[model samples]
Target: MGFSTEFNSICKFKSARELEDLFEYGKTKMRKSGFRIYPTGMKVIAFDPENRAVAIVQIKASIAEIDFQDREITLVEMDLVRPLTPEESAVETALAYEMFFRDHESN
Candidate 1:
């Protein structure tokens, strides 16, 4: 018998527009200080229950120029994922996880 595993991906977005597009469906916050919180656009990796995969991003893209309006890059790996439920999506990365509800009134 096998267990259904929890899949995870860590993405890093390089520009503002790219970040904006990634978080379109997510709750966005714009501060008066001009900072934002968006999804990280990183390559995906798959790991089974044993967690034996190399800690390396298998595929990568090198953009000569990152012009938001005139760029096309295919994301190498993407499995259909349902939009994150509010509770599920609320989980944050270790770096910023502490502020999850600190500024919720505005968002």
Candidate 2:
């Protein structure tokens, strides 16, 4: 009749892969259609696990990596390997940036 704590409750996550798996699923559990990763300088290079080209993700943030504590945010320069889309616009499925902005939000 009720859910269990171990399924969704917070606990000691043993490894990065485990956490990444959780994050991948976290996308669906989200109620908001949009998310903002502020301090845009903190954005890092990452890819979808399924190799799906999730483009124009309307104010959504893409996470390439994470650390639970002893965190550090730094900029790394790199050239763009390829474009998200050839037309410099979003696809129908990828219409992006509709969410309200917030300053204190954290990933």
Maximum-TM-score candidate: 1
In the range 29-89, model 1's lDDT, one tens digit per residue, is: 1211112222234444322122222122322332222236544322332231234343433
Each model's lDDT comes to 0.29, 0.26
Clash pairs, model 1 backbone: 11-40, 11-41, 11-42, 12-40, 12-41, 12-42, 13-41
TM-score of each: 0.25, 0.19
RMSD of each: 15.1, 15.4
lDDT of 2 by residue, 1-107 (tens): 22122121112222345335434543211111122122222322222322223222221332322235433322112222232453432331132222211221242
lDDT of 2 at 50: 28
Q: Please give the lDDT score for candidate 2.
A: 0.26
RMSD of 1: 15.1
Best by lDDT: 1
